[model samples]
Structures are given as C-alpha cells and as structure tokens.
Target: MGPGRYRFPVTPLAPGQAGPRPGGGPLAWIRAHPRACDTVLALAVFVAILVGAMAGPHGPHGPRFGERDLTVTTAVLAAVASGALAVRRRFPRSVLAVTGVCTVLELLLETEAPRAPVACSVVIALCTLAARTDRSTTWRVGALTVVVLTAAAMLFGARPWYAQENLGIFAWTGMAAAAGDAVRSRRAFVAAIRERAERAERTREEEARRRVAEERMRIARELHDVVAHHIALVNVQAGVASHVMDSRPDQAKQALAHVREASRSALDELRATVGLLRQSDDPRAPTEPTPGLAVLDHLIDGFVRAGLPVDLDVPRPADALPAAIDLTAYRIVQEALTNVHKHAGQGARATVRITRTADALTVTVLDDGTGPDGPDAPEPGGGHGLIGMRERVEALRGTVETGPRPTGGFRVHVRLPLHTTQATHQAGASGRSCRTGETG
Candidate 1:
C-alpha cells in the first residue's frame, strides 16, 4: 500500500439490502398470495352480481332473461372470467385472450342478470397488460379487445348499439389501461433520475479521492527531497570529522560541530514535514516559516561556496512583496542557481535580477554557461527543482518562463502579483524580529 491509496469495502447485496421490498411488506405478501389480488377483486364482483340476481324478479321480463333458464350458463362464464384474473400478472396476454372469449359468450347468453363480474375481469386484464407491456402492445391489445366485445354485444345481445351498459364497459376498460400505463411511465422516469444522480455522486467522490491522493504524493516528494539534501551534507561533514580526528584535531572538532548543526537542521525540517499529518488544531505541530526573498542572500552564498560564480542584482523595492510572491521569487532564484551548478560548465557566471513595479514583480536568472540547448533546454527531466519553482510562481496568479537564452546560456523568468504586499510586509517584519530575538 502506497501512502495515499485508500481501500473501500465491497458488499454483495448492498443495494437490495438498502430498503424494504419494493411494494412494502404487506403489498408484497398480497402479490405473492396464491389467489392474487386481482382474483380476489373478481370474486368480490361475482358475489355482488349473485346477490343482485337473487334480489330481482324471477318471472318473464323480470331480470331472469325472458323466461329462459340462463343462470347456469351465465354462472359458468363468470366463473371462468374470474379465474382468468388469477394469472394476469404472469401471462397478461393469455389472460386477456381468455377474458375476451368469455366476454363474447356472456353477450350471446343475453342475460338480464348483471354483467359486472365479466366487466371487472376485463378491466383487471387490461390493467395488467398495460402495466407490463410497452405502449404499442397495450394499444394493439386494448383496441382489439374493445372492438370485438362491442361488436359482439350489438350483434347477439338484447342491449342496443349505444346502450349505457355497453358503453360503460368500454369507458372503464380504457381508463384502467390508461391509468396503469401512466403509473408504469412515472415509475420508470423516477428510476432513471435516481440512477443518474447516484452516478454523478459516485463520480464526484472518486474525483475528490483522486485529488487527496495526489496531494499526499506531492507532500511525500517534498519530504524526500528535503531529507535527502540535508542528510547528504551531514554525511559529508561526518566523514571529514572522522578523517581528520588525529592529524587535524581542531579541524575535526569544527567538522563535528558542522555535522551537529546539519543534523539539528535536518531534524527541524523533518519535524515540519511530519507535522503536516497533524490536525490543524494540534498544539505541538510545527508552524515552520516558508523561505522567501529574505533568504535570497543565504541561498546565493551557498552556491557561491559551492564554487559557482554568481552575481545578484536586485533593485531596492519601494514596498515589500506579498509573502507568496516573495517565496516564489526566492525559489525561482534558488532553483535557477542550483541548475547552473548541476548543468553548466565549471566557473559559469550567473546573474539574478529582481524588479518591482506598482502591481507586479519580475525575477529573472540568466547563466552564461554551456547548459542544455534547443528543445532539451526546457525539459527538467531528472529533477523537480525547476518544476517546483514554476508551480510556486503560477499558484500566486503569476507566470513563469524557462528556456535556453539566445546568448549560449539558460534563463528563467517569473512575474508575481503584489496585491497583498503590505499585509505580508507587516507579518514578515514582526516574524523576523521575533525570530531574531529567539536566536539572540
């Protein structure tokens, strides 16, 4: 596991486990019942029609279908239509076919007894088909069922072509189908919106995680560079101390002192690096100062001691630059000089220039040495020093340019804003005074 990568748990049934069953427990139980809800509704309709039959007159022209013994036949047709409702959800087309046939048979019987049971069954079948199938299928099935049943009633039944009972069947069936279709469409639309929202949320979370990981990696890289540079110097001094212990005891003592100083500095920087992991409110976490323009002289002296010819030419500023801008300028100069020491030939002369204006400050470093040329000049492949300088400057809403100068040398130019220069000046002055007192 690298420093920044995170692992999240995976659950197999997570989505399904997130909620109760789709229709609520009771509705789901009802739907799973052996008889089905539609069948129960159909049976209720049958009982109501039977009660109406028993209450009516039984003589000729008195709800008994004109003295014909039609009770058995009507009862059988109603029973079959009611049974067909049980399988509506599983086989909606089949249920519709069976109900359609039963409807025709009931019309032929021409019973004055109520036809509500048959109509109820037809409504259930149409609702099932409309809810389950696409609009095209629903239209085809609904239209065919309506046309056939209406034709049958007018051709063989006692009712007139436009009788209320006949028209009632058409209206109720159409309304049930339409209502069922609307419910299905609304459910589908809601589901689509929910899926899109979830996907967007997941994308945003992944992006946030990626950014956090990248930041951690950047911090790790900085820590590595700081530790490596300081430790290398300490190691060199310690070697000198060991080599001169007998022949040059005083020089060896001085080298040991330098080693101790280097070790202490490394420890402070390492503590600062580790302190980044602490919460913002933690008291013991270090609040290390960032190196800024105030440190330019020290930085130049280090390169000079390292056997590089450097000339620093910074104009006196009318006002102090912003802390961020000052830091950018210092780092740009530091990285440029470091590159000259690493890439330029021995004894190269480098010039650093800083110019401040009302709104912006520009820092430019030019080295007269046999550095990289042509396209290779801009590629700081092995080291991030130049890249770090560029990033620092740009983060202050500034610009940076680095390439081979036309005069057989390398150059880096940077411009930074001075919008917050006054505040930064006050803070830096107070901080510097405090640091000086502590050192004293």
Candidate 2:
C-alpha cells in the first residue's frame, strides 16, 4: 500500500436505507423510522378503542368493563378507524375522511345507548390534518368535522340530542385542531430563526473578505512608493559614478557613497513595511517608527544630493497632526519628488509648499519641467504614483487634484482634514472625490 492510501471494509446497505443519522435518544429513533412509529401508534389506538367498546356506564356502580358486549360490528369499525391513522401524515385528508365514516356508522347503527370508541381515531386524524395544512384549510375542515360528527351523534344516537356524550365529541375535536395549529406555528418560528442566523453568517464572511482585499491594496502601495523613490536615486548616482570613474575619480567616489546611502535607506524602509505582515512572535521583525512629514527635510536633501535641486516652504503646526494624515502627506511628497527627479529634464527645479488652515491641511507640489502632455512625457500606463496618492487621500476622506500646470509645469495638490472627526463628518457629503488628469 502507498503511504497515504488505506483500505477499509465495504458494507452493503439495504435499499432505501442511508445508514443511521448522527443523534441519540428515543426521539432520534422515532424521527429516523417514521413509518414504524406510525404503525406502533395505530396499534396503541386500536387496543384503546377495543377496550373502551367493551365497557359501559350502565353498570350499577359506574362505568365497568364488559358491561356492554363488544360485537363483531363494533370490533370491525374500530379496526378500520385505527388502521387509517397509519398514513395520516402523507394523506391527512383521506385518513380523516375514512375515520369519520367509521365513526358515523358506529354512531347511527347502534341499538342501545351509543358508546362509539371509534371516534378516538377521528380525533387523532383531525389533529394530523390541522398540523400538516395551512390555517385557513385547518379552520374550514375542523369546523366541518365538528359540526358533522356532533350533529350525527345528537340526531341518531340512542341518547337524547343534548346528552353529555354528544357534546364531548365536539370538545375533543376542537381541542385537537388548536393543539395542531400551535405545533405548526412553533415549527415556522424555529425555521425563521435558523434562516436569519445563516444570513448573518454569510454577511460576516463577506465583510471579512472585503477588509482583507483593502489591506492588501494598502500594503502594495506602500512597497511601490518605498522602492521607486530610493531606487531612482540609486540609479542616477550609479550612472554618474560610471560616467566619471576615469575622468573624475574623486567625484566618482562621492557618487558611489550616495548610492550606498540610498540603498541602505531603501532596505530599512522595505524591512519595516514587510515586517507588518509577519507573525507577532517573530523575533526578526523590525520595530522602526513609520516615516512622516517631520522627516520632510531629510527627504528633500536626498533629492538635492541626487542632482535635482528642490525648494521647501512649510510652517510647524500648533499641535501634532494625526498619524494617518502625517504618513499620507510624507508619501505624497516623496512620490511627487521622485517623479520630478526621474522625468523632469536637467536643471528642472521643483518646489513643495504646505499650508495649514483652521480645519484643513493642504499640500502642493509644482515643477517647472516637461509636463505629462509634453514631448518628454512617459507613455500611458507607465506608473501608479498618482493613483496611489488618490487612494490614500480618499481613505482619509480628503480630496486630491493632479494635472499639467498652465505655465509649462506639473502640479499635485491635496487637502486633508485636521481632525479625525472632521473627516468622518465630510465623508458622507462628498464620498471618494478624486480629480485626476494624467500620470507622471
């Protein structure tokens, strides 16, 4: 035998048998064998009816067994009525009609005071009919059964029309219908509860999948921003080092040093971003703080060293900004400056400006270079920098605009709420508003 394979004995099952269901107790056994249960019920009802037919209240003391003879006719009618109950669930109306006929005959043909025990089977049949049918049908059939049986017993029985036995027939049948209706209602209520629970389970699973997809998108955007900005710097420096290795040895050494620094920064940022997906118990995971607007000066210096001079204008806020807004602001500036360094022609200087209002913080990046529509523009589908910027802004309920400037340059502008509560307030009013023109 193969290591992953096994053999087991095959047992044959009887036709119409599906093996035992998973459960226990007497109720489970009854549910598994309904036909056998119905047979037992019929036997019990037959015995009770036969015993009742052999007893009478005409005894000197009270009702006594054998006071009345159990004739062949009485026994035959009792057997017929009880036998009909075996198929009550499958054909409730038919069973009820058969039992009612037997009961009518036993009442109308009796020579003495009628003690028709066959009516017991009719009671059971009426209950089954009501339980298996709708309320309107149950009501209609129940009223007819009660009226017909009670009237037959009153008008044709040896006893008077108002005898206690006549009225007892009406009471028993009415109670059976009510009990059956209650059982039907309980079953319906339980079914409704089960359906609602299943719907809630499906809803929770869908919500979990949606959140997982969003998180993946966010991580992908972070990895892209980190790699593109640092790798662009490294590429430029490596080119400079190779071009001047023989002619300008000292300048080549300087360019190589910048390349090492940019690569180191890239590795550190990548480790931190990737570490978020590791297990909490992993000891090698990095715990460095996320970069934000506070490091704007250092970010700009890297670009300046890479040969693209940049100008900065920012004022310190009175209070610290939220963590999400701070990170988004930093990434937007990093990606925009990286685009300028890579695509903007030689001597194409860039400018970054930050303005803080009472309720909002705005960031604007401009470069006097060949814009997206210019001859130097990269082909369509070249990058996702502008798309990532829009996604980050929209997540915080902010707005972003990207396009070619009128005066032969490119522009990236964004407005973010100062307070988290303000973002929540405006989220419904202007949902996911992002105005984009072209990618760099």
Candidate 3:
C-alpha cells in the first residue's frame, strides 16, 4: 500500500521475462521433439542388441546370445516402435498397442531371427502410456501386454516357460509402469500444493485490504470529533462577541478573548491530527505527547473559565493505564466538557467523577445545565462527539452510556476494561497482575 510495494527490486522482473535459455538440454529437447526422442531411444536399443550379437568373435562367436548375426527384421521392428514413440503423449493408448504388437512379433520370431531382442523401445512406449493414462487403463494394458509378451517368449522362443530371461521381461515392463505412475502422482501432488499456496496468498491480500479500510474509517472518526468539538466552541464565542460588539464594549472584549482562545486550541489540535497523517520518518511530524487523564485538571480549567463550573474528581492509578484506554478516557472527558459549554445554558454546573478499580476504570459526567433534553444528542441523528466517544470505547472492548439525567440535565458514563483478553490470560497464569487504584 505504501512505498514498501516498490522498495524491493527482486520482484520487479516478470517470470520467463529473463534472457533466453542456453540451447535445449536433454529433457527440453525430448519435450520439444518427442518423436525424435522415441527414435533415439529405439536406435539405442537396436545398437545395444547389435553390439550384444557380435560381442564375441564375429565370424564364429565363442560366447554369444544364440547366434552372432545382425538381422533385418529386428532392426526394422525396433525402428518402427521407437519412431512411433514421438506421438506417444497425444496417442498413448494407440502407441502402446502398436509397440506391444511389435514386441510380440519380435518374441515369436526369435527362433528364426538374430540373437538380439530390441525390447527396450517397447518398454519406453508402455511407460509413456502408463504415465499419461489413468490407473485402470494402465493396469489393464500393462498387465495384458506383459503377460502376452512373456507368454509369446515362453511358447515360441528358446527359453523355458518359467525361464529367468522371460521373467526379466515381465519385471522390466512392470517396473516401467510403476515408475511412470509414480512420476504422474508426484506431479499432481506438487500442482495441488501450488494451487493451495496461491489461494492463501489471495486471502492474505484481502485481509490486508479489510484492515486498511477499517483504519481509515477510524481516522475519519477521530478527525471529525476533534474538529467538531473545538469548532463548536469557537463558533459560540465568535457569536457572543458579534452580538455585544457595540452594546457592551467590555463584555465584547472578553468574548473576543474567548474566541481567540477557542480558535488557537482548534488550530493546535488540527495540526496535531494532521501531523498524524505524516510519514513516521518525516521531520515535520508532531513530537507532542498525546493528551490523557493526567491532563484532566487543565482540561476542566478551560470549561471553568468559560463560565460553566465543573466539579472534577479522579483518582491516581496505582498501576499505569494502557495507552489506548488512557487516551480514550481523555477524549471522552474533553468531548463531554465541550458539549456542556455548547448546549448548557448560563448558571449551569457540571460534575466529573472518575473511579479507578483494580480491574476497570469508569468515567461519569453529569451536568444540570437546564438546557435541552440531550445536548450531545440534540436530534434523532446523533452528534459526532458521542459517536466518536462510543467508537473509541468499543474498539478497546469497552462500553459507553449517555442519556438525560432523571432530575435535570445530561449524564455521560463510560467503562473501560483495564486487562484486555490477552492481559486477562496472562494474569490468570501469573500472580496478582493488577494493582489497585489510589484515591485522589
């Protein structure tokens, strides 16, 4: 959201946007021209068989498979099957069928053919099929092909029915199918994990956006409360000064002085609120500490000087109050005093009482101003001061109560929990975590 998004240089480049890769590696080449891969594989098998046939003395081999010869049929069949492998991915089933038939032909004709069996090409094709197809298709085709090939070898070839050579063919084919299936399974698992990670990243971004929106709403409320309270005072004082400009020069001068005081306070608070919008590293940011209950006397003094005398009572806390609760308490008191000065008629008296306990803190403001029913809430649509106070209190898991006093004017009450949920948990595990408040 901030410059942090662009501060990192590593994520600037797009994937695959880097320079070209070096000429294709074996796997890349295979993927690019799979048919060529098949052809190469088939040729390798043919060469191995050819080398095996002439491994001993060429003219009359001393140690050979059966006969020392390079036959035409074996070469052609190996070539055909391996060449067919290139399109195995697109037609896995069809390629398996073709390669299987070729393998059967080679095994059946082994009696009259050369000593070499180029069966490796057929094995490769079957593996490709197994990797591409589902389990049922792979099992049915794989089992049938292995059985048919091994049976053909046992029935027509020189090897006996249970010969190790015949069994070796079964072993190789079975392993190929299993290995292909394993590769497919591993790929699917990795894909699933990648998809899950992407979903989690999206969820995290959505959560961040929600939090940012909530913070902006809170800042808007704070700005409204600060501006509304001081501006109301300034407006009232300015009206008084204007009304008495020619009639009572002394009273007009006093009203003008009050107007200046109210305007200066408003400007100072506005500057503080604006400074909060600055970057933390900015030198122009305000260095003044936030107002709290510690400044309650000075705050009430302003109202007293404004003609509405306030009886204040607050106790010193034995344990330090949490910063959020302290600031919220101060704001609630300030807003209440501001409303009393605005809506309360002349000769009105206000009383402020704060009770601090081991577990919680309570603030009450009662004003017998003999004015409207509810000053803070003059209409059906409530004023911003009460709403801001409620928001601040509720955000810290606190509650607020405001209504008309039974006998006379308005009453404002608020309760703030000293120990948060996390703090409560800590106190339960530790001993005597909270301290009692001192009476003042």
- In terms of TM-score, the best-performing candidate is 2
Ranked candidates, highest lDDT first:
2, 3, 1
* Cand. 3 TM to true fold: 0.70
Give each model a TM-score.
Answer: 0.65, 0.82, 0.70
lDDT over C-alpha atoms for residue 204 of model 3: 68
At residue 276, candidate 2 shows an lDDT of 84
lDDT of each residue in 277-351, candidate 3, tens digit only: 799999999898777888878778767766778998888656777767777788888888777777766678899
Clashes of each: 0, 0, 2
Deviation in angstroms for 411 in model 3?
4.4
Task: Point out the worst 10-residue segment of candidate 2 by lDDT.
Answer: 9-18
lDDT of 2 by residue, 1-440 (tens): 22353433333333212334457999788978889999999999999998988887567887789777788888899889889899988889999999999999998777675766888999999988887778898899999999999898888764777877788888999999898887677666655655566666666667666556666777788898999999999998998999999999999999999999999999999999999899899999887778988899999999999998899999965688877788889999999999898877677889999999888889999999873455745676667778778878887878888877888778889999776676453332222324553453
Order of the predicted models by TM-score, top scorer first? 2, 3, 1
Each model's Cα RMSD: 9.3, 6.8, 7.9
> Which predicted model would earn the best lDDT?
2
RMSD of 3: 7.9
